[model samples]
Target: MPPVSQAPNPTPLYPWGVPPSPPEKSRVGLMAGIIGGVFLLIVALLATLVLVGKKIDSSYPPAESTLTAPGTLLDGHYKLAKDDSPTLGPSLEKSWRLSWDAKAVHGVVVAYHPSGGDRGELIVTGMYGRFRNTGEVRSRVLAGNGSRHTEVKVIVAPMDVTPSGSRIRVSCEEVTRSWADGKALSYPVCAWADGNTWARVAYMTVYTARSLDLESAARITLQIRSEMVKPIK
Candidate 1:
């Protein structure tokens, strides 16, 4: 009656010196935790993007940015001076003031510095013309603005850079004109017109050595003519 020889402690065998495998429960928990962490991280990233997008969207002008005073603002081309590139420079605060008279519509947008001052103006004017062509409208604009301001240097001629399928023509010139900021700003007055109306888009870009592609102006006016004016019978 000797003590029964105890069987050797039967632990799972490993091929080499590999550690024992983790329990199934532990492994499952680890996988779950990893998956949960990844899900949460993705959600956080999406939420952050949404928040940022909302903030950016909220930057829009509180009130519909008015164009200089009161008349028919030809409906067609969207915002010329956006909060984006090219049209919008390095300024912060800006708005387009709209106003018009009997036969015309005007738009004036200005970007201002944070410190308090003016940046420049992106202006558009739409004038109602029953059966006038681009040349007539262009001539009228030139004569009116010229008579009003004497400071100018002929840089660009009233070229026929009109848009395709549009009777609008593009005309640009270099001049120093008075702005709302009470300063004489220099820029090229680019304008375009069709059979129905004429529009101008101006920026404080002085040109002495070169010219600008007034196609944008023409395109804008073209849209206006297409949308606002009815086709002739």
Candidate 2:
């Protein structure tokens, strides 16, 4: 009889299924966790970038070698000829041109110069014994400023012949660097092949007064290859 007093509809406990609100502390803790995770991810990414940058900076060609010795000038004319011999190596089978401009600069010793005619778009240089068939050979060809730097360096026995039969290995470290004036920039590509045989070539402006863009340098390099010369003997 007491309960019969209109049970008040049992107050419908929690308004039929509405879940209770989460605690403020719990919500704050979840937000903090998300923020902390994001912060850690950013820190990790930054650390990786720093490490990669350091590696690249250290790997660039060293500049000290450039300022040491003044390179010898090779301001002479040359001629080209055709080479169809099978034993001359693929590099020489193209057109072969030869010039004698023995010079020394920046510790780089030059042996031969090729103004390419049919040798492909490349210039091959023979370095000193540093590139002799034994130690190491560093050689390079610069097409121009901002152009691709092609270098050939190797370490081998004292009398071994290089892949191109150009030079032997001694000790070599080849590199290509850039220089600029107000109008245009120049790239000097240098390499050391065998002893007493080094090579250096630059794709520079035909006329120093004019701008020597990258395209021009590339074209010049191609011309040198097309007119490359080799020793027939």
Candidate 3:
């Protein structure tokens, strides 16, 4: 008796002409796609950085400027005097100034009571970057060779407020002193920084007085800070 032969398995075939994809090749393709996506993301980030840099350059005002003349003040009560001659530091360079490399600006403004006689004084300086040791720095400047009255440092109120949605900080210094005529004097100086701008204002007596109007001095300083935040036209 002969045994029946087992039938051989037939080759598999699909209705359409299709080829099987290699698993390794598929994996390599997926990896390539991921790398491409990452490269695109990096390029987008770099473009965003360039845009931000442009915005800052266009929006921020020039840190270096001559003193806001007494007449330019919003109140319009103060005016520069011919003989007073407020000192303006070196003229601003034509080149662009960045916040990190910008230098400080120094200038002066003098005023009179309009009715008669001297009406106190206002001085200003602006700069880029943060301010520190303000009290000490101002103290040294006040004790200049020309200051007739000895400036005695006193208490100052703490202020932390931003003007025009800008970063700002304020400080005050009160001192008692005597004039050439031996009249008791009150000097309250207020200082503040708006972003890269730093300014100081002091209430001086045209005539001998007992106490300085600190509130007025502080008010003026805050006003200056607000202006500093605005872009130059």
Candidate 4:
């Protein structure tokens, strides 16, 4: 019998007759790796943000059980007068009332005349309450400043202040507004918040020559807040 003809060897598709992975499979693997990497990165970022938030929350000032009126602050440079007048005008008061909670703890409007015979005054209008949202309240107070007044010129935009104790968050502004006497006067205004207590301060004077810078105004606010707000026992 004739020997069976051997089948001709087929041409090898690759060097060792083994083909590489398909292009589609390789693409799928690459995409999976990229997606996995992105997922991990996002998770890491979120974890970091959480850690930072926790740290910030821990560093905040201790919560107070109630608000206080210390009557005076800054070594008697400021005095909480018995007569709480409407020094900030009706429109601003209305805005504050709308922004703050109705059942707030302590609300007051007092003017601090220069302990000496000076003609300038610092008006502090504020209230203490549990703020549902501290940041929103602060922003609203800042934005609503001089809202209905057309003759107001902003001299210093709102800015944050870090006082010595780090017990409060303070923002300040400076503006020139037309007075009822047909003259323009500059005012240094500041807002203070500590998640529980909030205040608005305005330094006003008819003596245009005497001026208080925004830094001074912020410092004054810090002193006032430190004196007025006390941590619960």
User: In lDDT terms, which candidate is top?
Assistant: 4
- Count clashes in each candidate, considering only residues at least 3 apart in sequence or on different chains: 11, 53, 0, 0
Candidate 2 Cα RMSD (Å): 18.5
What is the C-alpha lDDT profile of model 3 across 167-218, one tens digit per residue? 3445556665555686655566666644344445555555423444555555
lDDT of 2 by residue, 163-224 (tens): 33333222212233333542323232332232233343432223321344333433433333
* Worst lDDT 10-window in candidate 3: 90-99
CA lDDT of each candidate? 0.47, 0.33, 0.48, 0.67
Q: After TM-score superposition, what is the CA distance of residue 203 in candidate 1 from its true location, in Å? A: 2.4
Ranking by lDDT, best first?
A: 4, 3, 1, 2
Q: Which candidate is the best by TM-score?
A: 4
TM-scores for the candidates: 0.37, 0.26, 0.44, 0.58
> What digit string (tens of lDDT, one per residue) describes model 1 on residues 1-233?
89999999877677467897776677788899999999999999999999997775454322311223122323411233432322432221121122121122233233211112334444554443232334765765655556545554445555565667654466665556555667665555666554444555555433311344456545644554444444334
Candidate 4: list runs displaced more than 4 Å: 1-67, 85-106, 148-152, 164-167, 206-211, 231-233
Off by more than 4 A, model 2: 1-28, 59-61, 67-233
Q: Candidate 3 at residue 160, lDDT?
A: 34
Ten-residue stretch with the least lDDT total in model 1: 92-101
Q: What is the TM-score ranking, best to worst?
A: 4, 3, 1, 2
Q: Global CA lDDT of candidate 3, please?
A: 0.48
